[model samples]
Target: MSDSEKKALSGLTLDQLVEFATESGLPAFRGKQLHSWIYAKYARTFDEMTDLSLEVRELLKSKATIQLLKLAHLEVSRDGTRKYLFELPDGKFVESVLMSFDDRPSLSACVSSQVGCAVGCTFCATGFLGFKRNLSPQEIVDQVMSVQRESGQRISNIVYMGQGEPLLNVDNVVHSIRTLMASVGIGARHITVSTSGIIAGIRALSREGLQITLALSLHAPDDATRDVIVPINKKFSVAELIDATHEYYEATGRRITVEYVLLAGVTDSPEQARELAELVRNLHCNVNLIPYNPTRAEDGVVTYARPSLDAQHRFRKIAESTGKTVTIRLERGTDINAACGQLHNSYVAGP
Candidate 1:
């Protein structure tokens, strides 16, 4: 087979690999062995599978390729956070972030689901780039492996919260989740798939029967405000989103996470906090209050700023008073522009 006709082995699940092996005139158990090499061992090339017979390896070399992302650029923050830009084979770029903290299981890998996002949330940097394409399952899985290799640390948590919306590319996201669990050995509870209120995607994920957590980027307390901040809310209203999230919790019995980005004067008001509490009070969820990360405005002005410390404190106080759990996610990787809503493919455009 020609190089252009070769298949990628990095993304396939055990079952899929088994099917491929059988079609290649090999035993089904050979598929499991291949899975161990590609996923568990993070083998970069086909030649690294020393356990397989040389004949079988030679056959695979002709028909298959263990493709991985080409690391284009890497930036490390003084605070120990690292951001990576991967060059896709097609020449598009995607971003991933590795965050370090002082606690056990501290390293978290924030992986992108698409090359660019279509959702177009006004506050996000990726949204401005428009939609390019959905990343393959292997591309999503490779981000975690790449981060692990670069950092030399096991990523305790994986967040589908980087360049694009995970639910927008649900199939690949779900496959990546399964691979992360079955191959990478990360617990389902540690993996999070975040969306900006994609109701259909949320409904579909509930039927997945996986134990991975779901995080809704509910940045606003009301539909009127949310519609402007997260444009997806205009299509799926906050009421509908809340109902769908409730159904997901009922089906999966997992507490969901609601992410609220604190944009200085917009979403960080005490009134907004109270409204947010009332909005999600009935649901089985916790809210992560994230301070906004600076990005270039539509007018080319750098305007969005993190809320003041006092404003954040007041907002948290009001939300906590409503008898719901809330957490203030400390800003990390800000210096390297790797914080929430700040990641942009610099190779394509400037901030």
Candidate 2:
């Protein structure tokens, strides 16, 4: 079999790895060692598994392969945020971001679920690139592994907020989440999955019993405004999406996160902020306000500007007046086009 045809060992669970090992005529302990090396030690190549005998290594190498994403390009912002562009085995590209904070010792990684996005959120650069294939569980998990190896820091938080709408690839995403928790040792609470209000996917995720945080990218409060920016909102609507979030909270008991992007004139008005506050007043959630990050203006793409600091503060104050927990997201990696809604794979021409 070709290398591509070989089993990818990086995404397998402990039991599955043991099955692979025992099926290959090796002892099950070898599978446990493989799990530790691939998920914990972040091994990239089979030869790095030095604990295995040479014969066993060669046999495993011939039968299975460790498929880690190849780092294509990297950018470091002044704020110590690092953005990585990875080239997949098929030559497609995906982006991952590692963010470090002055107050916290642990790092956070934002990983992509698809090569490009289909949601087509007007403010998101990734959506403008159009849709590509969904990334496998291996591809998704490997992003965290690669970032951890490159930064040499423990990634305590993982966000599925890069490149694509995570719920679009819910199966692979859930698989990767389990792999991250079981093999990589990241807890469910530290991992967050953001969606542009995919209602069915939200319902499915709530039934999974995983206590990971769910963030709805409800960029606008009303259906009319949401339909214009987040096209998916047309199908799901603002009220329906809010209802799904409430159902999710009831099932998971984990408070939801409502992600709102403050576009200069479009979404930052005081009235809209008040409307947003009232919209979610009864929901068990906190609001996260993201300042728009400007993308390169192509001919057909609509241009948007970030809200001024004063405008942002006014919106926050209005939302806070209703006794809602609201916070303006601290911007990161804007200098390198690596901030929120800025992962467009600009390193290459287009998707």
Candidate 3:
């Protein structure tokens, strides 16, 4: 196997890294330097680590890389939101978003786990790219580091809702989460993962008992409509999704986040809103209404044609009328394709 195919250094736990270094005839304490380089220094290359002995660095260089991802394209929106198209070594591409909101005692960064999405939510542009492969834990962590490198602002909270569906890539997703919780020094409670309701993944997460949040993209109220908007609903119905979410809450004692994206005439209707409110009332959850970001369908026709300012207000009322607490997630990054499903990296083009 090539160095890239060899052991992924970024995924190694601190103890595992120390073990690897010791087994290679280097002192175990050398592992601290590696972590410092990988996390603290964010070294781009093994050779850039100035503290390691020349011989030791050469021995390490013969085996692994100090890198994971590089920026392919970065577009800064007029509103200061930055979208990054990062190209992995294998040539597959994924996107990450950096949203700068007013300080609220903490900061946040949203990262992706796969190149394109297999989930194909009717509203997301990442689905347009389709699934390529799962990002290694290293690849996943690199995204956060890249944002830190570019913006110089340390991220306080992490959200896995940028590109591909996360839970589908469970092992790497879990590893990334653990790395964030254990090695990256972020509290598990501060991380949130959004998914398209993959039951198996939810069951697995429940068993692991992670405190990380799970946000379900519940675009429609009923199975018939949900099957059209979120295709995965055909396999895991609304009832199953709710049950899985309850399982998560039972295991972790944390409330799940229900993400409802409002399309112009579909999910934004007051009736749909009422159904959604009632549906979640039976579960342990909160509804986050996302106004659909404008983008073309795979067929090259525009979907989500107009913004739903009026529908938004009505939907909130319907939820509140049902005594459900509701919050509208404000849209950001439109000027630079920072909106959801708009980061058409291919269209981002040779820059």
Candidate 4:
């Protein structure tokens, strides 16, 4: 167990925390106070609980302690985008990115829930890295706070599209979302969960009545090509994904975001664009077209040729012509590899 987890003798569940506090010569309400401190205050240490009495604080020191993930390294791009690499308790590392624009309205923090990914998207670096264990809710939440601590701006929004397929770690992802939304300042609508089409988990989130936006990583227009790109498409096809997405919108009354990453001469064709327009014909969603970031390949190969500017404009026109609102996502940190599909360098090892 991690030192933090070991020090965290209090409890993991909410009810357990309250019970533990009551046993330490404190009232039941002490549990609520503790929750507010750990979550609302984002305390790094039990000593930071300034509202509690000295004696009560001592009791916590004996039984429990606050735990936080420590910073490992950071990469700052020339364009202001920054990528952070954090070392977990198990020696497995995960990354988070800060995408900031000079004139942008809100900041986006891409948070990872697992050490590596299992989705295996052909165009994504994270997927090529072998799967690792899932992150605890605290570890996931700490990434956002670490970013906040450095920038002094409350993370306006969060995207679970960093290193792992969030649906695989649904419990911790949901737990982190609940704590983040309860941050008193951040609203549920601002925290978005991006997934590689994990249908059951998507449906489950919808039933919870959360207003958090669901961004589906729709990298391909059809199942044939999608299966080659997003391996998860083998299990949950586009039809099934749309079915679940419809349920999500029906339950939450919020539109989902379709994150379409355009790869040159791969899935960005007029035929594909026309097919995609038909795919979301009846759904309530917008498409965000991200360009593929180049990286070295696992076998020392680099076949990924970045798309030309004219090709991108042509693709955008196709998307716009289909009547679905489309926006071409700009690369944030080309120098530091802060763009999407650029988060993994050491592990992916290839383009």
Candidate 5:
């Protein structure tokens, strides 16, 4: 099929695929077969649907195409974390990280939801690039399928913690989550959608009635520090964000995760930790402490220092003292530039 003529079959829901099949003069069951092949079996082409007859396969080949992401580059770190640069059809690039665990052989895929990012957090690499475009549901789901196929391992956890603010593209993200849960068979609890404090998105997701986890990137405790680091805080203050988080818990009954990125001398002070403890004291939530990832200094771009071990522990101690569950996230994939806040595909392209 010609590139311009063929339709993308990857984004279609099962019911839509059924409509496609029925419209093609085939039995409705062919939709289930096609869905199973594309999502469950990870078929890259129409020919891979061996259960379908040659006639149906040829018909599909003429009208539809199952397109996977074109792998532009793959970086594997010494710590066994892998970063993938996938070239979209429009020549834009997005990155995803595959993290491997030692205790269990499970793998987690951190997928991107946008080309760059509109949330211009001073220290984030993607934020430096600015927003490009929101990925379609197919683009989002393809990240997981690409990681699983390339890594030769099943992804047990899916984190929407990559390039862009997930809630900014809430509809596509939620659609991809449904596909991941219903079609791909990953449990709802295993999927997490992380947003940089989009109150409407959080409230919208809470109404979806799925058991998926909601992680809010609460990088600072007070509005002043947060406004500097997380610019979204300027619009929605810490108190308003917390109120929305509480509403999410009340509606969904799922414990929210408050993610804090520790930056040296900026947000890691003992006093800030106390403020953070007070900020989240009333919310039913867990705190995930992430160390700031360094990036090359560029003009007009803000750089931050990674917190020292003592500072990290001290902050964790203070946050934990508030009787809320808190844990420090072990940094991974930094060597490969795939750790938290390090994904910038513009620099990875060949000269």
Candidate 6:
């Protein structure tokens, strides 16, 4: 079988790895060694598994593959944020970001769940590239592994806020999350999944009982405004999405993160801020205001501008008046087009 057709061992659980070992005529203890090498040590090639016997390594190589993504380009921002453009086995591209915080010592990796997005959020650049396909659970986990291997820094947090709408591929996403927790040793609380208000996906995630944080991409407070920017809102509606978040909170006992993009004149107005405040007044949530990152204008796409510093502060003041936790997101990797709403695979195809 071709390498692509071979079972990808990266996404399998520990027990499954053990099963693979025993089924291959190797002892069960070999699987425990495989787990430590593949995940804990971030081994990318069979050759890296030096502890395994040469014969066993060669045998395993014929039946399974470890690495899935090839690093096509790496752009490092002045502020230490690294943007990785990875070419999949099929030649499609996806981007991941490694961000470092000044206030904390932890590093966060932002990963993609799909090659491109189908949600078609007008304000997001990923939607303009159009949809390709859902990334497998192995591909999803490989992103974090690639970032961790490249940076040589332990990723303390993982966020599904890059390239595509995560909940659209809920099954693979959840599967990858379980592997991340079980194999990689990253706690569920450190992992976050962001969605463009897919209510059914939200309900489905809540039922999983994982303690991971759920971030709702509610860029606008009302349905009318949300319909224009986040098209998913048209189907789910603002009220229904909010209700879904409440359901998620009730089920998981975790505070939801409401992600609002601060578009210059479109979504950053003072009135909208007040409306946003009233919108989530009762829900147990925190607000993350992302000032828009400029995307290259296209023929038919709306040109969105970042809110001025004064405008961003004004909106923050109004939202904070409601006494709910509110903070502006720290902008990172904007110079390299790696910031929020700026990931569109432009490196592969020119804008």
- Write one digit per residue (lDDT tens) for candidate 2, span 1-351: 788778877767899899999999999999899999987887877889888889999999889888657788888999999999888888898999999888888889999999878888887777777898999988999898888878877899999998888899999999999999988899999999999999999999999999999999999988888999999887998999999999999999999999999999999999999899899999999999999878777513578988889999999999877788999988788789685435444567653
Off by over 4 Å in 2: 1-6, 340-344
Tell me the tens digit of each residue's lDDT in model 1 across 1-351: 865468777767789899989999999999999888876777777788898889999999988877667787788899888998887767788899998886655678899999878888877778877899999988898888877766667787899998888998999899899888888888989999999989999999999988889999999988888888888788999899999999999999999999999998888887898889888889999999988877756523236778888888899989988788899997777778674335454455654
Query: What is the RMSD of candidate 3?
Result: 2.7
TM-score of 5: 0.94
Clashing pairs in 6: none
Q: Tell me the TM-score of each prediction against the true structure.
A: 0.90, 0.94, 0.90, 0.86, 0.94, 0.94
Total colliding residue pairs, candidate 6: 0
TM-score for candidate 1: 0.90
Give the residue spans of candidate 3 off by over 4 A: 1-11, 45-50, 54-64, 103-105, 297-302, 347-351
User: What value of lDDT does candidate 6 attain over all alpha carbons?
Assistant: 0.88
Candidate 5 clashes between residue pairs 3 or more apart in a chain or in different chains: none
Q: Model 5 off-target regions past 4 Å? A: 340-343, 346-351
Q: After best superposition, candidate 4 residue 169: deviation in angstroms?
A: 2.0
Question: Candidate 4 on 205-267: residue-level lDDT in tens?
Answer: 887788889999988878898898888899999999989999899999999899887788887
Q: Write the number of the candidate with greater lDDT, choosing between 2 and 3.
A: 2
Per-residue lDDT of 20 in model 1 = 88
Model 1 residue 94 distance off true place after TM-score fit, in angstroms:
1.3
Question: What is the alpha-carbon lDDT for the whole of candidate 2?
Answer: 0.87
